[model samples]
Target: MSQDLFKEINHAVLDLQGAQLQTYERPLKRLVSLLQHPDLETYNAELTEGLDLETFLEESARTGGSMVGSQRLLWPDSAEECLGLTFLLLQKMGEDPAYAATFAHDFYYSGSKIIAGIHSLTGQLIIPFIRDYKSYTQSKGSALVALQDVRSRKVFIVHGHDEGAREMVARFLEKIDFEPVILHEQANQGRTVIEKVEKHGDVGFAVVLLTPDDEGSVKGGNLQTRPRQNVLLELGYFIGRLSRDRVCTLKRGELEIPSDFAGVVWEDMDAAGGWKQSLARELNAAGYSIDWNVVMR
Candidate 1:
């Protein structure tokens, strides 16, 4: 039974990747609707039966709503373990289809013990499959609904004097269906540059272009290529405001970044093998649900 279930899940994931969602929707809907099977409810009951619901709820509060604590409290007996494993597998498949094969393989070989170990340690396996069903319904248009905000589609582009690099980045962004908010192209009116940036705070992420615009020295040593002061200033501002993960620095050539930013990852526009893929990864990490198969093609 577990092997059959795993085969069904594997096929669904492959279908989802290749299915042209714009022209056809039945396959995706059918896959998502599978989560609503009455068997899932029975499985859920098997895991939760004989558990003290009241005590679990109270302990959940005390433990800052830790799912591990809740799971331990509602520990499934040996007979109910397979049901719990199925529940967890469904959750993982919903979150990332790429992991479906790995999960299925582990389940086929090790059975429920693997899931039991995961449940006891990490609390992330708590999300029910029903939530994923709703996400699929909402993501029918562009998958942007999975992100839950229209404003998250906007990416602010910060650049130095390199109009060529900036334009290339902007065009790539457009191709991916992201709205690139270039400061120079926006209506600034009487507001200062800082005010302009502040007004456009709805941006989901930022890309700073570190072009070789100026020659600067660190501790009055040998001169080195660097981006404009304003570009660096905005980069710092975005890092502080939007978090370091939401900000990506793309350098054109040999550029000198501050020593304080030694650990921050930056992509080289020319040498980086696939800047588009890197940018897509950062945007996805920042909570934007992009269909890379469609966008990259």
Candidate 2:
């Protein structure tokens, strides 16, 4: 499986290398299709597990990195910080390439922030990543993922272009005395989208709105509705970070839901305002102090 997988990857990357910047979409689409294999991602997660912070710090002690400012410490940089992000973006693109323009996401940026510009992702991030990944794929790396247990009162609201639904959820959370954190409303402080998500990982719960803002499908398949790729990207992130119990996806309108998340909780974002009660129930189940009066009102 590994041999066949990388063979496909090698072929894809070889093609990507020969294509011009404007012609990248075809090779990228092929590569995105390859990423849907569960074995490939399982193998990837195993190889990169050691890069997690907890294990990185403790394991670094042997290399004289116990001190904060030690030269041997693995410091943050563009490639290191964007590793997980690029993978997530790839996952989203794989799910629906037609909507991938939101996530084909301009491959790499050299500066402190990932700026909007023309850069060949194939030449930059993918080529280097595959080179490094292949070198390490044969070896298994382990890491201790320290689960964040601090129950926060702040709820992160992940939304798309549905401003009405976004405002409705935010206001309802506020009405119940729960602080709603919206990414667009948050202060940037010059941080990129993914960077802001990394720092704000302490949210107690995530309310993701799967609104139909884009449409896509495979060749010959019917054009189906779906949320923005960024919404799906963040939805996957929160599900992994906070676990299923701490996350709820409010699907608005008729859209495609990822098959992988068939078991995860999902509520219909109806026009009659029934989703508020569903959210309040989820909040209470997660040990939040929810007042029926506020929820009823």
Candidate 3:
């Protein structure tokens, strides 16, 4: 039963994945039926009952700006939340067509969250949860389902010689509910530099601080400032590990910017405090829900 349901739901979700405006509703309606199924609600609740809604709702709740005010799609209770309010979105389309119509595509296809041309909907987030629920209910994936709703708030920060910049960024991230991972601050335990980064860097997002700590140029040419060598290396590394969209770069000092990489977002680490909102927008664009209130301050 679970296998059949998973297959059906996955197919419907795939149909919704890259669907165009004209073709979205059919698959979406199918999903509504699948989600509202009696067996599904029961099965999903039993398996997902253990995971807390708070962490799971962190990102989803941020999209409330697009939601129909009366709809309030987030139900703390299980079964509904597991689907990322996808079903409720349909309700919004009907109840408040004028408002919901604007962002309806977000409910079906998540093309905007693409990295290297790969699109994801809420962390692929729903599919994995369903898989975990199936596995856990079967008595096989107890550990996986137990931890699935625990959002990874860790963000990796790579910087060079700018303690002020690092501290400020870390504080801002903390304010917005992310644990910033700064390499030198971690316990060495005899591990090398790369080893430390590898160990403490299982983060979903990476913020690179490109502050000028060195200067160089072609052998005969006048030297131009540059970020430390390690900063560039780690920037490239995280872009590879986490994809370009997941990593953000903050430029400071006099260094020339790195070559533009697709999906990688960069912001001027400015002092007028605009960088906070800028960073917030980038993080939200990458699928993390950012609170404008906190960002505005």
Candidate 4:
């Protein structure tokens, strides 16, 4: 299946050359139209099956066509489909490094304007992929070593009054090459806690410790333990600053989460026995590129 797809992709590359020389606009427009067709989904699925998407994209970028040509290509009518097909082709090219490198070179140099135009029309998509791709390629050989630079990768630790739990989390973060930013430790003399948090807003990610620090009365007049008011505030702040995925909530005990924010996923720190593995997963999902093998060991 991959071989067949590779041949088709090679044919597309050949078509690109012919289209550039002869009737430029028509063939380019037709190719973009064909990519947007629903049938392309099958090809995309077939090509991506059992493939490591990030590695495929990285290899594709490092292989394939010449980096010199500049051709005016037609923008896909559907930006979503165009982006999807682009990713699929990159994955398909991964099966053949020679083809992948050739396609990658052409895509990067010649298709730059086409991608830019797609971004201009769609308003989002492609820029983030490009940034992540660049990061993936740059850290190719020494990912584990790169992760050890705490200064470059900072994780803000939001915790309640549970000193032990917070310390444990901080130590775990440090082991994974993350510089844990504790609010109290880094508080400025004149600034408020909120102000201090804002000061370190550039931190890539945050981990909120939801330890049972405070008791609250429920509708049935039963008292339940919950995180401190400040902890909740900081959690909300991080959620706003760095989306839900980038902010991980680690619950230590039977804590009652707020009704409004009940949908947020919380990992049980006690149940896990060790939080490092789960933390590593969160870091990778949040685009940190953590090599778990080194960190876990």
For every candidate, C-alpha RMSD to the true structure in Å: 15.3, 19.6, 9.4, 16.9
User: 18, model 3: CA deviation in Å?
Assistant: 16
TM-score of every prediction relative to native: 0.53, 0.49, 0.60, 0.52
Q: In model 1, what is the error at residue 210, expressed in angstroms?
A: 1.1
User: Taking the tens digit of each residue's C-alpha lDDT, what string does model 2 give over 1-297?
Assistant: 567886787777655544433554677678767765776676557434544544444454455434322324343464433344455545555566443443233222222211111123343445555555554444433222222222467899999999999999999999998899999877899999988987886787899999999999989999999899899889899887766656888998999877877777699988888999999877754445568998997
Model 4 lDDT on a 0 to 1 scale:
0.57
Q: Name the regions of candidate 3 deviating beyond 4 angstroms.
A: 1-120, 123-150, 258-264
Candidate 3, residue 172: the lDDT equals: 97
CA lDDT scores, all candidates in order? 0.57, 0.65, 0.62, 0.57
Lowest lDDT block of 10, candidate 1: 119-128
**Can you write out model 4's per-residue Cα lDDT over 192-271, one digit (the tens) per residue?**
87889899866867999999999988578989898999999999998877666567888898878898788788888975
The best-first sequence of candidates by TM-score reads 3, 1, 4, 2
Candidate 2, after superposition: displacement of residue 27 in Å?
A: 46
Stretches off by above 4 angstroms in model 2 are 1-150
Which structure among the candidates has the greatest lDDT? 2
- Model 3 scores a TM of 0.60
